[model samples]
Target: MNKQGTFVAVATSILAMAAAGSASAAESGKFQIKAFATKVAVDGAITKVKVDQLRLPAGADTRAKDAWVPTVAAEYFFSPRVSVETICCVTQHDVRGSGPLNGAALVDNAEVIPATVTVKYHFPLSSGVKPYVGAGPAYFMVFGEKVGASARALGATKVGLSSELGAALQAGVDIPLPGKAVGLSIDVKRYFVDTTAQFRAGDRVVLETKHKLDPWVASAGVAWRF
Candidate 1:
C-alpha cells in the first residue's frame, strides 16, 4: 500500500483499540493519541555564505518546497489542565534557487525528521471546546540530501545538510465529539531552526552556506483518549 493508505490503516487500528476499551475507563484516561494530516512550509533563505568557490550571483537565494505528510502525536496528561506531548513524522523537500538563479535546483530530495516535545496548558471553557498553547525544544534531523542537477552541472558531486536544534511554539484547539473519548484536533506550530549546507566536488569543498529553515506546521486530525 501507499504511504497514505498505510497511515490510515495504522490510525484506524489504534482508534479501534482505544474504542474497545471500556467507555468509563476512557472518560478518565490520561493518555491521548492523535493522527494528523500535516503541512510543512519552509523558509529556506540563505542567511550567510561561509565559502564561495562556485562564484554564485550577488542576489542568489534559495527556497525549499513545502510538503504535506501524515503525522502522529502522543500525549500524557499530568492533570486536567496540563499535558506533555511528542510527535513523529518525516517530511521531504527540495531547495531551489530564487532571484538571480531562479528555477535552478540546489538540493534534491532532502528528508527531515522534526523531532519535538512540548509541555502544554489546556484552558477550561464553559463549552466542550478546549484551547491550548505549548512551547518546546525541537531537533531537525536532515538526511538523504543529493546534489541537484544545477549543482552537478557546476561541478558539485555531493551535498550535505547539518542537523540543528531549535525551538517550537504551538497553539491549537480540540473539540470533543458526542463520545468524550474521541475528538477533533486542530494544531499549528512555528519552528525556529537553521542549517548549514555543504557542496563538495570529489574531496574538495566547493561551497558552504547557512540557511534559515524556519517552518510552519499545521495539522488537523482525530484524537483518541484512553
Candidate 2:
C-alpha cells in the first residue's frame, strides 16, 4: 500500500478506538447552565419602502441601530445522546438619524424579549471535546417606549407572537474539576432568530418591523450532575 494510504488507515483506526474508550468519561446524566450575553446585527434596507419610510433629515442617506442585552439559559440532558436547551434574552434597538431634532440628532429606542428551546445531539471528538447541533423554536415579546418624540410613540410597546426556527452548532471542552463531581466547560453557540410586528404610531401604521438576529454566544460555565 502507498505510504499515504497506510497512514490514513491507521489514523482512522486510532480515532475509532479513542471514541470508544472515551465513553466512560462521559457517563454524567443531566446537564444545566446559566450564561450572560451581548448581541448585535447589521441593519439592511431590504426594500425601498422600508428605507424611504425611515424618518431622516438632510445630510444622511442611511441609518443603523446598535443593540445589546443580557441573557441566561438552562439545558437538560436526557442522555449522552440527547439534550434540550432553553434561553431567555432581552434586546433593545437604538435608532439614529443624521438630522436635527430640537437642536440635536433624532434618536429612537425600542426593546424585545426572546425565549428559545432546542433539542440537540452530541458527538464525541478525538480531543475529548463534545460537539453538538440542535434546532427548534423561539417565542418573542416586543415592547418599549419611543425616545425624543413629542407625542408618546407607542409603536414599539405592542406585544406580538412569533415562531422563530433555527439550528444551533456548538463545541465545548469539558475539563475535570475537583472530585470529578463537577466540570468546567466553555462553549460557543450561534442562534438564528427571525420575526415581524404589527405596530403603530399615533393614528398611522408606524411599522411592521421584522428582526433577524443571528447571535454568537461564548459561554464559560459549570456543569453539575445529580
Candidate 3:
C-alpha cells in the first residue's frame, strides 16, 4: 500500500482493536520494562541549502543509512489504561550524497540519541491483548559526526549536526504471557525531526544545509510488568 493508505490502515486497526476490547479492563501493572531489538530507518534528505561556499553540484541531496540497535523502555502506569513511557538507545548513521552527488559520502559515523517521552492509552481486550497509541515530545541529540572521506577530499575539515527537538507518534500491541507479568510486545514510532549540517574547512564554514531526519523506529521484544 501507499504511505497514506498504510497509515489509514494502521489507524483503522487501532480503533478496531480498541472497540473490540472496550469491555475488558487492562491488566494490573504499575510498572513495566521492555527490552527490544530495534531498527531505525532515516530520511536524511537535504531540505534547504543555507550556505554553499564549496559550490555544490546542482540538485545535490543526501541520504542517511539505516541502523539496527538494541533499545529499552520503562513505563509507569497511572491507571490500568493510562501510562507514561520513555525509551533509551543510541543509533548510528552515515550520510551519503544523492541525486547529483550520488555515491559520494558526506558525513560519517554520526551518533544520535533520541530521548522520548510519551503518554499512552492502552485498549484492553478480553483475550488479554493490549493495543495502544501514543504521542509525545522528543529531543534528538547528535554527536560524534565526522566529515566523510569525500568531503575531506574537498578540503572539508570538520562536520557537525545540530541537536533539535521534535515529536513522535507511536502505535503498538502487547500480548500477555501465561504468567501475566511477562508479555510480548511489538511497536512502531515515527519521529518528526530535522537537523542542520555544517561542514567546515579550516576555520571557515564551507557548507550549511538543513536536513529532515524523520525516522521510523520499529521494535519487537519481551516486556515485564510489576
lDDT of 2 by residue, 3-78 (tens): 3354345445534543554454455457666554445453412122232233534443223355555566677865
* lDDT at position 74, candidate 2: 78
For residues 1-226, what per-residue lDDT tens digits would candidate 1 score against the true structure?
A: 9433543454454334334433324233389899999999999999999999999999999999999999999998766666779999999999999999998999999999999997776765888788987777799999999999999999999999999998777889988898467999999998888999999999999899999998999999999977
- Could you say which candidate leads in lDDT? 3
Candidate 3 lDDT tens digits, 1-226: 8544554555566445444444454554589999999999999998999999989988989999999999999998766677789999999999999998997988999999999997777877999999989777799999999999999999999999999998777999999998667899999999888999999988899999999999999999999988
TM-score of 1: 0.87
User: Ten residues in a row with the worst lDDT in model 2?
Assistant: 44-53
Question: How many Å off is the CA of 25 in candidate 1?
Answer: 18
Query: Residue 18: error of model 1 in Å?
Result: 27
lDDT of each: 0.87, 0.50, 0.89
Instruction: Give RMSD to native, each candidate.
Output: 10.3, 9.6, 4.5
Identify the leading candidate in terms of TM-score.
3
Model 3 scores what on Cα lDDT?
0.89
Ranking by lDDT: 3, 1, 2
Query: Candidate 1 vs candidate 2: which has greater lDDT?
Result: 1
lDDT: worst 10-residue window of model 1: 20-29
